[model samples]
Target: MNHFQDYTNNRSRLARIDASLFFAPTSCTPLENSVLWIAGCRPSSFIRFAYALSGLDIQFHLTDFLEGKRIGDLTTQQMTKFDELQGETIRKERNLCSRLASLQEDIVDQPFASKIFTSKNYEEEDHHYQFENADEALDEHSQHMAGVMEEADELRMKTLKQIVINILEPVQAVEYLAAAKRMRLCFQQWGKKRDHHHSNKLD
Candidate 1:
């Protein structure tokens, strides 16, 4: 129950942050913008996020064992159930990925009218490519992609919530959530530093 409350509070905080970032992007630092980009400017790759969480889970278990702590310990049955959930989640993610790939193919395979002119009478214009009804086609495709990506993001959150609320104990869930947040923050910071380093090298 406490974890759920914390989640709700965090969601509200994030909503405010998102609003601020969108409405006043100039006020945000370059590192903040870069972190947001690294975190996915459009739809995030939920599968990759899930894998990272799985790695964290392993590390958490190993850490607990090393510290001889009884807290945040999962039983054999819980572990088995988590494995099943992971498999199911991956299957759903794969379907979403396939849909995205198909949409990409549709755009890539689309045929456009093209012409080439070699004559000097053409005002030096050499080539032209015309895509009829491209706007409508692209708008529809974008809508479809948005819907699929929204569904995927929702699924990702739902799965994480289920794991924290339904599968893990309250204490364990709290610890896991904290660790996950830390990991995400660390990743963002590291990504920002790496981008800065690369930019300096390019200069």
Candidate 2:
């Protein structure tokens, strides 16, 4: 029966591939080009601030990622704060993407809802009612999780697309998009293999 493994696997893989595309080379690209990668990130802004503190040199200091230096060694507070700020930056980027291209639209188009609800009908008559109730519960949980993941995926993809477009211009953006699509397809195959492996374990 159609389920996450059968149907929604493709989209989930796409999301991961998108994230990797954006994140993998961002740090090593030329600073000017990388600026586009960090356009709305808190960590980027924080790093910039730190760069300024270090006299705007190309080299970044460890102190930049930290907050204050009251005791000589790096404090957990600094690391945690840096992580939090970075997280906020990602959150804002995702939110902006939602407004810009309606990422939610694509996310909602995934076939998980229909698959989950309809697949339960295949249950034998004796278990049909029981399966129906259980399926409804599963569907509810899946829907909620899918909504969240979909939003996150859209944000990640948009961010990656925007960065690649900025760095490579229109032509390269198209190529990158194509690559991202292929990567997603690969992810689907990977997920199917994994799901099958897990299913075998259960059997």
Top candidate on lDDT is: 1
* Model 2 lDDT-worst window of ten: 65-74
lDDT of 1 at 36: 45
Off by over 4 Å in 1: 1-71, 111-124, 128-133
Report the Cα RMSD per candidate: 7.7, 15.9
Residue 195 error, candidate 2, Å: 1.2
Note the residue pairs that clash in candidate 2: none
TM-score of 1: 0.62
Off by over 4 Å in 2: 1-161
Query: If scored against the real structure, what TM-score would every candidate get?
Result: 0.62, 0.28
> Which candidate should be chosen as best, given TM-score against the real structure?
1
